[model samples]
Target chain A: MRIFEYMGKELFSRFGLRVPKGRVVTTAYEAAWVATEIGSVAIKAQVLSGKRGKGGGIKFADTSAEAKKAARELLGMKIEGHTVEKLLIEEKLHIDREFYLSVTIDGGAKKPVIIASSQGGMDIEEVPENKIVKVHLDVELGIHPFIARNIVRRLGLDVGSRQGKELLNIILAAYKIFQEKDAILVEINPLVFCGEKIIAADAKVIIDSEALFRQKDIPYIEEQTEAEKLAQDLGISYVELEGDIAVMANGAGITMSTLDIIQRYGGAPADFMDVGGGTDMEATAKALEILLAKDPKVIFINIFGGITRCDDVAGAFAKVKKEHGIPVPVVIRLVGTNQEEGRRILREQGIEAYTNMDEAAAKAVELAALVPAGSL
Target chain B: MAIIVDQNTRVMVQGITGKQGSFHTRQMLAYGTKVVAGVAPGKGGSKFEDIPVYDTVRAVLQEHQVDASVIFIPAAFAKDAVLEALEAGIGTVVVITEHIPVQDEMEFIAYAQRKKAVLIGPNTFGIVSSGKCKIGIPPNQFFMPGPVGMVSRSGTLTYEIAGNLIAAGFGQSTAVGMGGDRIVGLTFIDVLKLFEADPETKAVVLIGEIGGNAEEEASVYIKEMTKPVVAYIAGKSAPPEKRMGHAGAIIRRGKGTYEGKVKALAEAGALVAEMPSEVPEMIRKLLA
Candidate 1:
């Protein structure tokens, strides 16, 4: 998960990388107080999305009153759809030179890659490819001392020089943090050399969500839409999207295929929900309830039942209709293990489940088109 | 012969006494797979479903000379279980446990490489060679031995496409789930290479989604292969940077997009199907 800059910097400090002293404040008054103590601070809005500087979510404050004004402008403002709920006030740095360094998994290579460049401040993509030196770390042996020195030397810094030593330390620390935190990425956009020292001007750390179970100390921030949160509470995977048709399936592959088929037939899917394998009747009912909250014009349920029982899905459909009453048109396609029993259950409930996926997808799209836009 | 396994392949089940282990073990046995033995750390000297249970993989290896091992241990102890199987000289290890720590996977994958062993997955559904043998949890009815070679990242999606192929009068030579994780051991290229060399396999079906460079990398290799290939990529409508059920399914930094994968595969001469149901028709046309 992507963390706030303050959290990333906090992690950097713990890993022995130098970061400018920073304080997190929630209100404009507190931002002013922290800025006064820091003396010429950078006021950064603590939102998850990047490009905050270009989006005007970041500001420079020379004095306490200026900091207050900047904070006021940043607070309660939405930058890239995320509101600035908190501000990170950090001591401004005087840099002799700026460089970039990051350690991230190269998905194609299936190895950890270190990307270092002499250019900084601008987007890494904007930097010319020739100026950047990329190195892939061995997954088994990890980062050798020579590999670290190679990156720093290529950046044109002397190994014995203060900035060079500091750069090496920062690179090592970043790799350590990336490894220890089970992080997918750990990046310092501008590792600035200030006279005799180097400090991380900006930091970004993204922890692997699947590895969160082992890293118990790191706090997980649940950033989700209201509909997403509702699905989470029901123990189902849900992703909110634009459009009027609600899409539900028993597996991730079928769910995505269902989504694709709907769009192929000129229908827009409002959400993506997967009930997962071996789901029972109650869980299916809960999944239905969560999707119902999205209030789509059509609800399309597709189950390619393997270990997942179709009878359970049919039972849930019957239960949900008998209790909550579905307001929209429901289209379902059930196949595979226990499919006959599932179809029988749905048929008894006066709801027909299609055996062909193509037929079901077309029908759902046709029904969705029949409803006027914004009618739901 | 199939790429990974056939009727003659000897198999062993690790964590055989556990709930999922016993359940899928029975399923595998019922499908005519040569499940010779089982291994549960403390369940040695016991028998599960008429199969001898050993405490360690070494002991199981002593009696059966197993060709592959399908692991069904809990996520917490999966790394050690796989390591044990690798250490016991099992050339092929299929890890069926999901949610294994990435660190653990990294270590085990490196170790497996050192031992010259093939690690299928840390979160896979294993491999099935149609009517010959089945080593995974895919429903038996969805498969029938024939000429199509299939490789997929997701388990259910593989089954979905396989069922569609069967309904359309096509059958699979070998279907492999390469695991739906970021750091899977067996990749699309790895399985594709095997399928390319297998005589029974006539064409290839690559099942991928909107994450990782597996599909992109596979396209590079497919550009040279002579066998016809058809692909179905999921998550075409998925949002960027959101985990869509599968942990590996995400679009980050403008990479791993559905359109990009489809374009690459199409450029490599592989027919790209818009939906799972469409894959069979594409394969039929390619062979025709």
Candidate 2:
């Protein structure tokens, strides 16, 4: 879960971090007022994804009139497919130096690792190796004063300076927030030093998905917070790998088997999604919205029935095909419990069903191979 | 020698008074798991499935002398419940509850490691010790004591593989659903080591999904194992850049994906089965 800048800054303040004074605005009028109050503000479009500057999501304006214009243009602009719904206008800082600091879960190590660097405002990834210092911490130890002191020293901060002391406090605060929020990553990209004061210029936080349940406010913006929303939305649970053939199966097992079969037939799967055990007509139709939207060359539905009735799955496909037309070629693999009824329904409707996973995979691969290279 | 739980393992139930806790508690009981005691705050003196219920894990442990626990607590209470169980000297703790906070899990996993205790899942189905016992929510009908040891991150995939193994005239010594959470207690390598040491288990089946380097890390261990290991990775049919499935399954930039793990495992000499269903057959061949 991604929390917006304003909320994150509020958290920063609570943790005794020095965050630059900022106010969020929803409309251009509000942005203009904010610019007037802040004086020489940085107007930034609220985007959840990283690299907002690259997407022209941030603009600096000297006057309120300029701030309004920038906000108006950014209000409805789409940066990285997310429409800008809000704008955060912040007070500009006169900075002498910028530093990088973040704490993230290192999944491989099964512990939280703190990364602090002298390189700031540059993507932490692109920062030179010498500029970046990584600190591996055992979670059992939690946040120790010695580790915090080491990070401050590694960044080459002048411990005697007031700004250095302030920056150290902010860094420790960020780590506390990371631990408290169950954050996958909490980054203060440019902890700026402006006239003997350390302030957070920009903040980014990525919360852990596993921790969302305890963090109640996190789900208010969730894609599925209610049963009604889930019932209406089409959600296929599977990872999307780099492949060309798309597979739709009833269970996770059959979906994986379908992927294997496709690979064996000299083709790669475009996606892996299971419609779950015995889905509804609307759900099947929604699955198409998710699967076909990927624009795959071909689709193969592998349904091995048990609690998941085959004819019900077939009926879902038939309904989806009738309502929303699918552009790509498709293959149906119906087996197990409702094999007879499902096969008969498909055959009667002039759609073919294969009992063998290999044959269906082969046909899907063949169809995918026929797609023009440029089209694919 | 399967991982985590095996035939001789004794199990206790945590949060046994709640609805889900009671229901799965019955299922675990029916599966022949030696569920000696139950724990629920102020719900002691009650009997669930004819098993003694205590107010706390400490009380349950003192009376029952049980070392392992199956947690049926809700997500909100999951962290504290796990902490209580671990603090009570439980040897292996299986947290069946999903949605544990990552911060809570980070603390729990670290604390458990420090205590030298095995914590299985934060979002797990639990562990099955073949026909003798089940300390979690796996359907009892699919398992029979045999030579193969299985460990998986996915619940249903574990069931499907175990079912196929049953159909193939093979059975399992133990099947551990390590849980699909990113901060789960036991990694694939942790369970693989136990399987390697188990005497009853001749081979191991590892069901891996597309995400994380857990499988790759386990593959390194598989090469050192004396037993044959069959491996299968899900998400072969995954679309590019889609973050579906479990949170751990998300594809990062240049790390923890299906393709990289596959190459690593294949090089480690584990026969990679692309299809989930074929894993049991592949294991059978490897064991033969």
The regions of model 1 sitting more than 4 angstroms off are A226-230, A233-235
Which residue window of length 10 is worst by lDDT in model 1 chain A? Answer: A227-236
Index of the highest-TM-score prediction: 1
TM-score per candidate for chain A alone: 0.96, 0.78
What C-alpha lDDT do the candidate models reach, one value each? 0.87, 0.77
Tell me, by DockQ, which candidate is best: 1
Query: What DockQ results do all the predictions give, each relative to the true complex?
Result: 0.72, 0.40
Give the clashing pairs for model 1.
none
lDDT of 1 by residue, A59-96 (tens): 99999999999999999999878988999999988988
Candidate 1, residues B43-90, lDDT tens digits: the string is: 899999899999998888677889999999988889899999998889
